[model samples]
Target: MKVVETIKAVRNEVIAAKQTGFSIGFVPTMGYLHEGHVSLIEAARKDHDFVVLSIFVNPLQFGPNEDLDRYPRDFQRDEKIAQKAGVDVIFYPSVHEMYPTNMPMSIHVTSGVDVLCGSSRPGHFDGVATVVMKLLQIVQPNEAYFGQKDAQQLAIIMNMVEAFNVPVNIHGCPTVREEDGLAKSSRNVYLTNEDRAEAPFLYEALKEGANLILSGETRRSVILAELENRLGTGSGRIDYVDVLRYPSLEQSEQLSGKVILAVAYFYKNARLIDNYIVDIQEGEK
Candidate 1:
């Protein structure tokens, strides 16, 4: 597990790997490694000859009032976990290395950024697309791995790859969750003991939404109502509950094909999100 912090070093090593005909897999992350992150690493290790995990907490993705300053970090602990997950190289670059100067041009995100998380957080996906493009350019891997936990982000990245003709194959792995069904996140640590106890309801609500959709419910408003009702059992503040087409993330009146039941809620100071996707055939219940 070699760790390199400079842009030149990462690019040089990746170029060397390409010259040697080794297939590279990349996993880009904001630090505070958790089981969810490890799942992506493990997937990359399984499919590529070498796996590169970059743990740079991107400043661009964060809004002014967001948790950028307090966003968690423990590089020492993350290094151990990455090595254990069979990561070949850890690209731990500094902010200066990633952004030595202000970005000269903004990566305008046309699609997959006007809804869901993107709707509330303006310029968020632009930041995500820009940083992801930079990292993808630096690594120039044959394949890259991302978790389905950030479904919208995954969709945006996929869109960016297709639109820009980036050569890397993008893979969206399943969302890793706790035994009780809460989706694993680095921010899960912010939950109070009471908040943690109520947090699993986020997943439970999404599951119920999936079940309802699977049982032949097609109305969008009904499903949203049911999901909100299910999540309301907890003492948490509801952020948003939405259902949209998978990958495309467009809104639809009828639920069919692959659809995402996504929800975000605030429990104390912690904001938690969870979702369940259900694919319904043309005529099947």
Candidate 2:
């Protein structure tokens, strides 16, 4: 795979590909390649004529005291992984190359910006939307792939694209998990052995929430209480446990339509998040 660090270099190649009538598929990521990331690249490879994967640990998306500096980086390893995953080009740009000046304008959505991770980490989604907007503009891909693991972030980006009328199509892929049911994350490496053992409960709790919803329990508060009971095993301090309407991130009484059961917890100095999305049956009212 061709790896270029400059935006101009990447843009020239993308323009060339477009001129040749090739549809571009883009997967934007913060480097620390895992099987979850590879899964997205594989999906893009299957669908698009040309696939571009970007590895930029966007500083704008990180909070002031967050793990921006200590967040992992291994470009050599990531390069090998991307090439093996069939990426046609890797946009490995430095932070300065991508952000030459201070971010004058930021992207924010009023509705979904105050819950889940947004509650704790304020301005997180704003950074996410801004960088994603910049990347979409730079890559100019026909389709972009994002994992559903960050269900809220995915929803916010979808809303941003729709609100701004960006031309690129966004595809949300399924969450990839480990054999033990822990949703795969680059931050999983920070887990201690004990913390790792207790981590799968996040997924388990989400599954239990789904089961409760399926078994005719329609009240969101009831399911949320049960979810908190399951996650409050003292394994890690609970950050938030929410069941919001999917994509919109709004609260609802009836459980019909797309709904997401989500949890975020702090375990062993690493913050972990997991969620399960369920499409509730319509005639349950």
Candidate 3:
């Protein structure tokens, strides 16, 4: 329940925790606390002696035309939620604290940033990797938690960890969804009443595509066509629907081992993304 806004203060506390032999678990978020975000904090709390949650709305991850200024934030409310989730420290830093004037350097991961969300939003992953690397350096946690709702982002972070040899364990948790199946997102607040009702179809369509693959369909074209058909019924503008390998995220023609069905669409002024992972059993034919 302790809230620290300065990076030096948070870093000092983390250093003290390490000296005391306490393991730290970190959850980095662009603040608009939801069940999905709280779920990440709770998971971190379970495995580590101390849990730190960062609530800075990263400007780097947002494009110039994107909703960075209007992105939802309520730190007072977020603090309460974090405390309830057993969070030990809430690292709420200002933009200047995270990125000083003339911050020239940035981190980039080349493996999974060329397609899907990355393809649509140029320079998005660079911002993500940069901020994440900075946060990891500041907190120096033993582990970090991210939701599978952002499958590609998770993959990119994991790739960065491996390639850079950062000594932190990156854990991808399951996507938390509403009862009707819409993947919970902070931007869900931007949807209209009608848009909210129709939004769940994104997840439904992904589930259907996964089921089709499980039912012995291997043709990527046919599966993607079916997914598009289902998502087309929703009110949002469909961005993309793709099926690819698990961590590699390359397009796949056959359902062999681990496959992911991912989609992104725009509802109202908000763009949302979701994905599902399925294990394709061998010898099903």
Candidate 4:
């Protein structure tokens, strides 16, 4: 339950914990802690001896016109939540601590950046990958936890860690949802009551799409069309509905291997994303 604000401070704590033979678990988040975040921290607590939670809202992750300033901030509130969730050290750093200067190089995956949330947000996943890379390096945990709700993000980090051969294990924990099946998110607070009612349909459509593929209806167009239509029933504008090879995030006419059914919907105050990943064997179910 220690909150330290510099990279050195976190490293000192992490090194001390490791010297005591405690395995570290890391959860990197932009503030506004929620049920989704708690799920990841709980997963880490279940497996690791020590947990480090970093709460810097990365400026690089926000787009130029994307309301970076107005995103949200309440360290006092988040600190209470993190301690309750069993975090051992909270790495709360400033933008300067993370960036220091314009980054000399950025981690960008060529394949996954062209679709889903990455397509609209441009350099968003690059920012995500970069920041996660920084945190993973800074914290140097035995395992790091991420929610599967950001399936594309999970995939990106998974790919990056593999390519770069980062030592930590990346765990894509299951997406936690509401009683009515909506994927829990920090952005859920912004949804108008009308948008909230319709938001659960995103998860429903994902479930339905997975069912369709499993039932021998494997055409990509049909699946995407069904999801777009289902969620776009005049509720919010449909950003994209995609079925892609998972982890790689590449598209193909015929689905195989790990596949993810993903969507992003634009409500009045929030743009929400959700997905369902299944290991698809086209003929054998």
Clash counts per candidate, in order, are 0, 0, 0, 0
The CA-based lDDT of model 3 is what?
0.89
The sequence of per-residue lDDT tens digits that candidate 2 reaches over residues 26-142 is 999998999989999999999899999999998877889999999999999999999999999999998889888997788865879898999898889889999999999999999
Question: Could you give the C-alpha RMSD of every candidate to the true structure, in order shown?
Answer: 1.7, 1.9, 2.0, 1.8
- Model 2 TM-score (2 dp): 0.97
Candidate 4 lDDT: 0.88
- Kindly list the per-residue Cα lDDT of model 4 for residues 147-238, writing each as its tens digit: 98998888899989998999999998898999999998888888888889878888888898898888877678888888877876756888
Higher TM-score: candidate 2 or 4?
2
Question: What's the CA error at residue 166 for candidate 3, in Å?
Answer: 0.3
Who wins the lDDT comparison? 2
What TM-score against the true fold does each predicted structure earn?
0.97, 0.97, 0.96, 0.96
Mind giving the per-residue lDDT tens digits that candidate 3 earns over 194-229?
888888888888888888989888788888899989
Runs in model 2 lying further than 4 Å from the true structure: 282-285
Ranking by lDDT: 2, 3, 1, 4
Off by over 4 Å in 1: 282-285
Question: Which ten-residue region of model 3 has the weakest summed lDDT?
Answer: 276-285
